[model samples]
Target: MPSTRSQVDTLESGLPYDYTDDEFDPDYRESSEEEEDEVPKTMQRDRAKWIEDNVEDIEFLYRQLMRDGRSMFGDSFLQTGTINTFANFLYRNTTPFSEA
Candidate 1:
């Protein structure tokens, strides 16, 4: 019979994983990896045009009442989803909000 500790280790090892270093990929993370790895060959040719079409950045800030004056950056990147959401917000930002 397997003990709790052994069962936990088995479950943990079977769980799944993905990283830039992974040679083979699981179906779930494969598509995402492709998107991040290749940004369309056409875009790579022209730096300005490429950046204009695909959103990108290094820093961000949220002026919301709760998180007022707060900011985000590459180091603050929690994960792919979080970074994507914040980056999208910054890309579309046109004006700042005030707490007053």
Candidate 2:
């Protein structure tokens, strides 16, 4: 029977770990190989076009935010749904927020 120390030492990870210096070295990677692993850049659409397309929804949401602010500021709290909707709108409009 193995001792606790021996049992612990013999436990298998089953992953390849005994790589040679040359095998997993970064210098061995070709430029193309590194490039292939990189994330591709996404193109930005026109904000004006986005606003134009989503005008009704955006205006409705913006009005709701403003109304809530006017009536609730220091008087009442906003619902989590309202805050989440605003946050999600900001998240989706990345280019506009990133510039700010």
Candidate 3:
């Protein structure tokens, strides 16, 4: 059994005394690479499904904004320059329209 102090040290360090640096190990690297390859396909499919499910709500919000003649951002929301700037900002900063 580990002493209380040793357990505390392990918790503080966020690692066990017997922990090996598997990152540099070839077997570990190969398994991680396989995981990485599988991750993107799953992520993309999930993202697409989320977008599909929410698209109607998104469109409804846009229509409401247009009908009310109110810009959620500000009074200048309808201006082309403001729209361009906002679009550019969103494109640069957001991931897959999530931020907007």
Candidate 4:
């Protein structure tokens, strides 16, 4: 385990401002299991509208960061192609998607 000083120093680096409150809960980091729970009708129905308002700005920042990160390392498309081939190998061996 890391020492407390190292963990506390993480905040001095300036975390991204767009980090969501939803991710704070360990349960909803993301969901892949059956979401049997339904949203109550009383809740605001404009949730999609709210997300639409900001998603583009969020995506723009994400793309900028990715671009800057790539420039810093000077990586090549071959790196992605190699990863895709490896993923295909794993998926083909493990799932019916390969047969289709």
What would the TM-scores of all predictions be? 0.22, 0.32, 0.27, 0.26
Candidate 1 per-residue C-alpha lDDT over 1-100 given as tens digits, one digit per residue, 9 for 90 to 100: 7666633423456754434446464543545644543433443444334335554332333223114423434333343445444443443342233101
Considering only N, C-alpha and C atoms within 3 Å, which residue pairs clash in candidate 4? none
In angstroms, how far off is 90's CA in candidate 3? 12
Shift of residue 53 alpha carbon in model 3, Å: 1.6
Clashes of 1: 0
Query: How does model 1 fare in lDDT?
Result: 0.39
Q: Predictions ranked by lDDT, top down?
A: 2, 3, 4, 1
Candidate lDDT scores, in order, read 0.39, 0.52, 0.48, 0.45
Stretch of 10 with least lDDT, candidate 3 = 83-92
Candidate 2 runs further than 4 Å off: 1-45, 74-100
What tens-digit string does per-residue lDDT give for candidate 2 at 1-100?
8566633323277644445556578679546733532322332244445556766777677777768776867436454435335533554555444333
RMSD of each: 11.8, 12.0, 13.0, 17.1
**For model 4, how does the per-residue alpha-carbon lDDT over 1-100 read when each residue is reduced to its tens digit?**
8666644423556864455766786776564322312233432243334335656654565556557767886665235433323333333444442333
**In model 1, how large is the Cα lDDT of residue 96?**
35
Pairs that clash in candidate 1: none
Error of 4 at 37 (Å): 16
**Index of the highest-TM-score prediction:** 2
Greater-lDDT candidate between 1 and 2: 2
